[model samples]
Target chain A: MKQYQRSSILVIGGAEDKVHGKEILQSFWHCAGGTSAIIGIIPSASREPTIIGERYFNIFRDMGAKDIRVLDVRDRIHGEDKGYQEYVEECTGIFMTGGDQLRLCGLLADTPLMERIRQRVKLGEVTLAGTSAGAAVMGHHMIAGGSSGESPNRALVDMAMGLGIIPEVIVDQHFHNRNRMARLLSAISSHPERLGIGIDEDTCAVFHHHNEFIEVLGRGTVTIVDAQAMSYTNQGDVSAEAPLALHNLRLHILGHGDRYNIKNHQPIAAVVE
Target chain B: MKQYQRSSILVIGGAEDKVHGKEILQSFWHCAGGTSAIIGIIPSASREPTIIGERYFNIFRDMGAKDIRVLDVRDRIHGEDKGYQEYVEECTGIFMTGGDQLRLCGLLADTPLMERIRQRVKLGEVTLAGTSAGAAVMGHHMIAGGSSGESPNRALVDMAMGLGIIPEVIVDQHFHNRNRMARLLSAISSHPERLGIGIDEDTCAVFHHHNEFIEVLGRGTVTIVDAQAMSYTNQGDVSAEAPLALHNLRLHILGHGDRYNIKNHQPIAAVVE
Candidate 1:
């Protein structure tokens, strides 16, 4: 086991407040060393990688980061390129933008660039922030695509492999706003051992102390699904498209300033100042 | 443990040759006591349950059945009706037609009519034959719906509760014709403990001796997927829609006249007579 000196992972739901009170991004900015942060923006998930990459680069730059680099690796070759790999290794903070998670994984999966980022993040040397599709890729088991506004069932969600940045939990973005509770529930039905975290739009679940805890931030609430205590689920017994019944799954809804212990699956109320 | 004296289950893939030969249906008819058979047709899965039920009624009538009743229960109330429950109880064999499995389960699941059928089938007092969606619902864990031609992944299949006529196995119909290999593989990834039996069009996997053995019949073949020896699976690790990798899953393909030991997961070739 590696000893971590300092590590922080900021997971933001999609459609964060970019103009008024950019609290989530600002929190990410401060955690990335603020004025002295050497930031790298990865927008490979977007169809317009350059535009998306530049967008994040400008946001971090405007926050007074000493250096900002848009490392847009569009293909496997680009992902394997030494220049991109070096930037991923050297960046103090890395931000991944949202678009298509399949495309992102297709281009970067198993690449040296992702391996380096994973290594640095694991070593507590870099602060990583991802939003929307970016946030979806943080789990070892990723939800590549799924529909909302449906009952929880196997057909409601699609899952794939992820970057394993946070292997213990599966993350969903634009959660409650998009009626993704069913979708996330469908995902967790297959993986009861991992925690399911749904970050509402503009919300952030900031991980610290080696991902042992999460501090909810921003205006929206974070929904936590803990199935470790789940007694029964018809997931293995049922066919697709059928409504599922899951028993004993614990759910927690937390607002800004609320903290949660990931290891213990417990919630901590923030002390009023 | 309840000792099974004589129990036979015919799981037919869809599009069985009702016109020519009709080897699979003939086997089912013979197992149902041939000329002395008192059969009940449950077409609750079909949109036109009455029509589908009568169609099977006519087929059995043509086969010189002593008696045949089309027990077309379309709703839960109908499933609970004493008339339907009596028909289910008196029938020597039950034949379920293919349509929408979800609809079938919605109407009949947990109903007294279905409970009586389950009880009789488990007691080796009745022979049961279900085709297509009916076949899909034989397992304790059912495959309600799914898409074909996709790589094996969680998204490729949807699963729901089934009749559990055969609790130890998951069955898929129209196997080769519809290219349901990946679909069955996807279903089995979530349920490695249950045997996967994919019956090709016009084929049947006849389970006998308390479902411990299966004898293949009809023009097509039976593909058996046994994941008991599986060493690893990325099913829990990947998100939906992403391709999955399952290692050491043993697959067996058997043609007409071949036999298999379900408990041992071993195939026995046909003897030259």
Candidate 2:
């Protein structure tokens, strides 16, 4: 029930610019404390955690982060180590890379190390950024796997328990790039209480202000599927593969610099300063 | 909440023998009062309700039933007709033919006629038989549409509201012939409270004695998937297309003359007469 009052959670879609501009990652670094940032890279979701961790470590280090460590946890036991917990506790920024979300939850779900990270992130002590698989795990109801380029249906998207970092929303990364709108819509049909957020590749939905608002950053757009006021859905009675029919579902698209009010479920037109 | 204390609800899988043995239909005829039976054929689910309805009416008539009426209700307004309600109320036997479960529900869901039919069935006033689409709509959570021949996942089934004659179960007809075991499993994943019943072609599952017991009659087997004591399922968090993983799901297969306890969720092996 705790809200992110002072914390900044950057939920990035996959395939972020690691080479050139790094505008999205730069925002994360700035929010994470710039040169004074004590950063921790969590590549547990990746198949090759060492390579992924080192890659992120280099990204932050080259961007002027003085204190950085790669918390390459392959197994759940690694999350129990006191040393990792201490490091997570002292970190000003945490970065989670893309890979298998089930593996991510399997290794870090209930570990004390994850708890410490969540606590620091929640207490406004650290800024947390999760891309792809990491972004997928932000919601309480996570989407582990699904297909794209299909009409929304009960069988189009698969879901599982999420990390609950931002419990109110279901986040899907690489949205437009993978043609995943229908997938997200299907996921929302099952759980209408949760807001559906589809962040495009290279894009980021920056949640701030107690998680009440979202600011779109980087290239591409963010699609929001809100079924809070859904009038009807055939999800409960049909078989999984049947095409789902949902009525009165609200949708919003936010491009770069666009702002949204999560509480009100409304889009705010971009302001030119 | 009304238990079927004395009702005989014949849930038939599609392609029940119309020409040769006609065993399933015979059981329905015998249960309906035989020579004294006043049968009403409801072919509202069929694309050509008149053709389907008349076909069933003729079948029942040829089987020695003295009185038979084809209530070919194609529109929802037809369900509001007092004539239809009166006929439904007077009929000692009701037969629902196969086609589209959604169409059937769309026309009859909350109609006075359907209410009357449901009330009569619940009160043990009528012996009702539904085949294929008819069988599918007998449950509270109906498998309106879905695919077969695949692994069980959230996306394999499409469900909708049914007539709910037997509220505790979900029925899928044409089971083994279409390889729909995965489809039924997917449906059960969404609703663990409902008992899943997959009836094979040419088969009938006859419910009797306060809906507490099910007797499998005819040629094929009835597959039952019980998730009441299911220990673990990734259904809650996975995507729709992702293959589902379920643990501790109880399964039972019953052939001709096999009896099963619906209340206890157990199979009573076929008794040697």
Candidate 3:
């Protein structure tokens, strides 16, 4: 339970525009201090770990990161390798690719590599960026599984422990494109103490100043579900499989250039010229 | 966030045998210092708060409690009333009735009354007991709502803030009778950091000595879902609404006279004479 004091995180909704311009990836690179950065690509979440690792390696190299290495952690054994630990220790930026979130946790959670990554991020020496499943693992309360298009219902989503880089929030990737509102709403309704963030495709929510405010970037919207002020829900009285009824759920949809204040639970309007 | 250093709590599953033997209620009374105890019945969870309050009032009185008062917190305004605050402050024991957990939270959460109750409990001056919906609100990660019968799935259960008397454990009531194992499993899978306790009907899990160990009483069993050592879960790769696949989920069933150690995540065998 190492508390992150001054870490900067980029949680991208899945399907980031890698082909067109790779702007979200570029933003992550810039935040990592541009050409001076030593980047590490952790592709443990992907089934084809080496392939995805090379994918990110090339991307970061093409963006002028002189030193970029892919740490292919295929299992617990690889996660325990000292060489990978050294890579994590030396890297200024760590990028986690989109794939299976549980794969990421199963391989890296509680391992030495995970510890080093957390330590570096906590000391403000690293900028961690994750997309899709990578993004989902950023929060402690990760939305591991759930369906789209359905209204809020009991047992609509399944959860698993995440990497815990962000403790107070639950992250959902491929949000609007998959119609994940019902599931994310259900998630926050259950755990109102933690903020629910739904990041859409091609978008990224940059948590700056130790996660105080998140700046939204990319083509899609970031939906924030805050149930702190919620008044009522029929969760107990209703039968299993019944549609959920929640009241006073506060939602904020922010797109490119917009910002959201996590502490205040309000949206920050973009400054006008 | 006042943590309870040395508090005693009695979390009962629904349908306790109040008329036949009244063993569970008697246990709660005995733990509250017997005859000299002044118990405050918070019937905010019940729809007919006054009627349900009086029912418990008679029950406690018949159990030979000298002073029993019903704190009718109908709304947030009533929760702020000075008279109610005094009642909560002076009471030696507090009992929350079973009904709608959300109704209880909606009326009392963050109110002056809740603050006083929390303070009293934290100082080890009050014995907090709840049944059914009452039991659900004992933990910070309260299982606000979820469906039964279905296999573990995404968004199967809903959560909200609870009284925080038991911060580390998630309490589920009417465990076996309603078949709530699936939802509780789903809950622990998502938040492995917290322990999930599912209490069966007519049974009560008594957490004494500052929640070091839980003593089981009554007829049914208390199911403990410990996912701390879980090896894997299909939560990330499975589609929404698909049956959840989890491996290495440790479960313990405790009946009368059994004890469970929370810190060690193991059951202590009952001593034989």
Q: In model 3 chain A, which range of ten residues has the least summed lDDT?
A: A1-10
* Cα error of candidate 1 at position A169, Å: 0.8
> What residue runs in model 1 are displaced by over 4 Å at the alpha carbon?
A1-6, B1-273
lDDT of 1 by residue, A1-273 (tens): 011123789898888878877888877777777787889888999999988888787788888998999888887888788877777766888889999888888888888888888899988889998999999999999998887533466887999998889998999888755657667878998998999988877878899888999987776667777878665565786577754545445655565676789887777755445
DockQ of each: 0.02, 0.02, 0.01
Measured on C-alpha atoms, candidate 1 has an lDDT of: 0.79
Judged by DockQ cut-offs, is candidate 1 incorrect, acceptable, medium or high? incorrect
TM-score-wise, the better of 2 and 3 is 2
Sort every candidate by lDDT, greatest first: 2, 1, 3
Regions more than 4 Å wrong, model 3: A1-6, A237-240, B1-273
Can you give the lDDT of residue B100 in candidate 2? 93
Among the numbered candidates, top lDDT falls to 2
Question: How much is A14 displaced in model 3, in angstroms?
Answer: 1.1
lDDT of each: 0.79, 0.81, 0.77
Across residues B63-143, which tens digit of lDDT does each residue of candidate 3 receive? 888689998888789888988887777788899999989888888888988888888887889888899989998888888
How well does candidate 1 score on lDDT at residue B269? 61
